[model samples]
Target: MRTDGGAAAVELTVHDEPCRDAAEVIDDGLGTANEAAAPMHEVRALQCYVRSADGQVLGGAVGRTWGLCAELQQLWVAPTHRGQGLGTRLVRAFEQRAIERGCRLGYLETFSFQAPVLYRALGYEVAATIEGYAPGIAKHLMTRVLGGS
Candidate 1:
């Protein structure tokens, strides 16, 4: 291939030797095996809830997760039911899941559109603050400590 009227070249090579042995493979695989056995270090999804008794869809919380920490990606509650404590309930529910996962610390970032005050009142401390995260939106980095399971 040629680009911008310049000569172009490409090269490819393949190695013939085996890249890893039994011990190396075992070492690499051990981390996953150990985590599975421990259970707390396992990564998992965030849960959602609805008003089952009334068949009303309330809201949902989504999480982006690492081995032991989960980041709340999105939280939405229907406007008609805003002041009845649904957000607090959802947060507590997510916290339970985090505790079960043996997470010592949970971190999340909220843009200008998010509910920063709610999180702050729930014992989540502001770890870092970023100005203008998205045009007029400030980003708040929050963290909560979860006791080991």
Candidate 2:
């Protein structure tokens, strides 16, 4: 580490091991930030899975409720199941579950090349857009009103 014109320019080294366990640190940071944002509330994971006749998981959504919103962390379907409305069904079911858990809105982040159209068709509106993620790649943050909110 050295200083240039009184401005410190610190050298760095990459380590295979973490300085501390990341998960616990992240949880602690989240707890602190969430506490500052609002009174601590119980966060419930909401999900919906579609299975085959033999009970193989085919597609689903996973999300959790924070405050009054459902965070849509992931939604996916087997390639063989695409274009058949399974994605729609999964999203609908997830939103319904979020509603039951007292969430008044659904929030999700998606890449521009992904299912932006599908989410829009499901009544999600773009809350923010970031361009130039990598050339033509972009990121979209979307939200949908749930439970009449």
Candidate 3:
């Protein structure tokens, strides 16, 4: 890429896989800009997992909390564990931790064929939706008030 004057050039490299260094750089840059814009810009990881008595991992919920909001990045339950309510438990646990961390709102993205119904049962409402995310599927951006806040 060249500047308007064509005196300077910049190179852009794309990676097939995740680049930790690039991620750190992006995080640092965003953190700095966000902190400059707001007082509550600190981000923290929040995760919840379910394990069996034999120590086998069953389900998990991964997310982050920043300011007054919590974002549920991913949630998964083992095929054999589906319909057992482990998903609900994991979500509740994740939300409980978020509430403890002072997050009054919860947000997450789910596919139409994924856990949108479950999230709705857990009090999440669709804030936005993108149709044809893949094939016949849709992407839903959901949100809910945590701890009645």
Which candidate ranks first by TM-score, i.e. highest? 3
lDDT of all predictions = 0.75, 0.88, 0.92
RMSD in Å for all candidates: 10.4, 4.2, 3.1
Q: lDDT rank, highest first?
A: 3, 2, 1
How many backbone overlaps does candidate 2 show?
0
lDDT of 2: 0.88
- Evaluate model 3: give its TM-score: 0.79
Give the alpha carbon lDDT tens digit for every residue of 53-129 in model 2.
99999999998887778998899999999999999999988988888878898999999988899999999999999
Off by over 4 Å in 1: 1-42, 52-54, 133-136
Between candidates 2 and 3, which one is better according to TM-score? 3
Clashes of each: 0, 0, 0
Residue 56 Cα positional deviation in candidate 1, in Å, after optimal superposition: 3.5
Regarding lDDT, does 1 or 2 come out ahead?
2
lDDT of each residue in 44-145, candidate 3, tens digit only: 999999999999999999999998899999999999999999999999999999999999999999999999999999999999999966689999999999
Rank list by TM-score: 3, 2, 1
lDDT of 1 by residue, 1-149 (tens): 33344475655434587556755876779976877777644456777675747787788777855676878877778888898889888877787787777666777787757788888878788898899656778898998876632
